[model samples]
Target chain A: AQSVSQHNHHVILSEAASLELGCNYSYGGTVNLFWYVQYPGQHLQLLLKYFSGDPLVKGIKGFEAEFIKSKFSFNLRKPSVQWSDTAEYFCAVTPSAGKSTFGDGTTLTVKP
Target chain B: GAGVSQSPSNKVTEKGKDVELRCDPISGHTALYWYRQRLGQGLEFLIYFQGNSAPDKSGLPSDRFSAERTGESVSTLTIQRTQQEDSAVYLCASSAEQGTKNIQYFGAGTRLSVL
Candidate 1:
């Protein structure tokens, strides 16, 4: 079965700090990757996605992710994270002809 | 609706009782998916509905769980003889279609508690 692994369960940082959330998936086929964020009281929303084209994709707010095909990773990165960025981030991956699989999720806490 | 909408928002039922959760996908969406999120856990895929047919239901834990969709708009997930372990948030998502339009829009979710 395909699975996504998010190494960190939680991360804490002060405002303006750089952030990186690690995500790796176990699919060997042509895959599509995505990053979804869920705010404290809001539903899960798309942060970014990678289907094809550039390996580096930018998303809503100031979030961005790099799709490293060789490493099977799509890590989310932010140069300066704010308190408003505090939320649970999920990494999802789906094969070209398969259902999507989500990681356990990483809770990011940005302190002011 | 403008976005995916799930009914009840919260449901509490006793063990052995049956509970039905409803999901109204965004208009024009042809793909609907159901997931379960246990406390401190990731989203667990439950079922997928393409139009009115469920092509993939491999994530259903057991026979106690079943889901059906009405055409391509609404879907209902039913839990029979609910167990305490069934307590979790049921989420519904819909997307326009496969391929380049696979980005899914999620709902607020229905939090189910089986005591």
Candidate 2:
């Protein structure tokens, strides 16, 4: 069974601090990657997605992820985060079949 | 219509009782999916519906769980004799089609508590 691993469970940082959330999936076949974010009381929204193209993909709200096929990792990164960026981030992957497998999720708290 | 909508935002049921959760996908969505999110855990895939194809039951945790989708419009997930372990938020999502590139829009979710 394919699975996603998110190493960071929770992370606290001050405003303007750089952020990186590690995500790795265990699937040998071709796959699509996505990053979804949920605010305090909002539904999960797509932040970014990677189907096929350049390894680097940019998402909404100043976020970007690099898909490293060799490492089987697609980590979310932001050069600087704002206080409003506080939310739960989830990494998900799906093969051509369309069933997505998600990681445990990483809770990011950006303090001002 | 605008987005995926789930009925009975919160459901409280006693153990051994059966409960039904509903989901209304977008107007023209061709794919619908159900997922369970336990507290502090990632979303677990439950069942999937794509157009007229037979629904995928591979992700269902047990036989007591079943889901039905009328065409590509609405879906209902039924839990028979629910247990405390079944306590979790049930989320519904819909996409344009059954493929990796299609983006899925999610609903607020139905919080189910089996007492």
Candidate 3:
């Protein structure tokens, strides 16, 4: 079985402030990691994903995440966040494809 | 539509009643999944199908929860004798690949409210 843990429950930041959200997963086999975001009253959409190659992966809206294999972590980062970035983020781990286990999610509130 | 679609964006029902939520996957997507999201909570896996066959259903909370897919396209999640605990947003996602990593496109989700 696989599981995901998000270190933070809620995060607040001012516009242009740097941001980082921590995620860790536990799985015995090959791992694929993903980050999804849900804006206020919007559907959940893909942020980024990491499967192989470079540990650093970038996604839409200037968001990025680094896959640290040794740490069992895929943390999302943004150098400068905007008010529109306010949303809830979820981290998921898939041992294969299709089926995934998700974390509890972290709510991000970016103040303008 | 270009993305996954869930019918009846919002549904309200009385406790002990029955409700059915529908999901229409992408045109050719072979992998479909169901998840539950409560207020201020993350998505909880419920079930998944690969080509109309359910291979993973360990996430279903209990016997009251059941789901099925047909023609490798549409899927329906049925809750028998719904409880207040069943009140949540039921999300559906679809992916094209079966074994490799692929982006799972999500639907707007059906909000199930039990009164």
Candidate 4:
């Protein structure tokens, strides 16, 4: 069975600070990666996804992720974050079988 | 008509009771999945149904938890004997098919509270 691991449980940053959330998976075959965010009182929304082609994928709300096959990692990044960016972020992966696996999630708090 | 819909937005049941959560996938979607999300936790895959295939039940937590999907439409997740630990949000999502590129549409989810 494939599994996903998130390096951070909670992250606190000031406004305009750069952000990077690590995500790693344990799949040996080709995989699809995704980043989803859940704002307070909101449903989980897709941030970005890596299916194939380019290793760097950009998503909504100025978020992006780079897929590194050799490292088995797809980390989410933001050059600068705003207070409105505070939310819970989740990294998910789907193996060739189409079964999706999600990491534990990381709670990001951006202070003004 | 826009996205997946789940009924009984919130359910409160006592321990040892049975609870049934319903999920209505997007129109024409051939694949539906059930997932559990405990408080402050990530989604835990439960079951996946594609058209009429046997259904991938590898993620079901236990025998007490079973789900059934009629054709390619409505799906029901039943907990035979609920426990306090079963308190969580049951989320339902639908995709076009079993592929890596298909984007999944998720419902608001049914919050289950076992007291």
- The best-first sequence of candidates by TM-score reads 2, 1, 3, 4
* Alpha-carbon shift of residue B13 in model 3 (angstroms): 0.6
Give the 10-residue window scoring lowest on summed lDDT in candidate 1 chain A. Answer: A93-102
Off by over 4 Å in 1: B52-54, B99-101
TM-score per model over all chains = 0.98, 0.98, 0.96, 0.96
Flag regions of model 4 displaced more than 4 Å: none
Give model 2 RMSD, 1 decimal: 0.8
Candidate with best DockQ: 2
lDDT of 3: 0.92
Clashes, model 3:
0
| lDDT, model 4 | 0.92
Model 1 DockQ vs. reference: 0.70
Model 3 over residues B1-115: C-alpha lDDT tens digits? 6989998999999999999999999999998899999998889999988884645898999999999898788999999999999999999999998765967899999999999
Give the higher-DockQ candidate: 2 or 3. 2
Worst 10 residues of 3 chain A by lDDT: A93-102
- lDDT-best of 1 and 3: 1
Tens-digit lDDT track for model 3 on A1-52?
7789999999999999999999999886788999999999988899999989
> Each candidate's DockQ score against the native complex?
0.70, 0.84, 0.69, 0.69
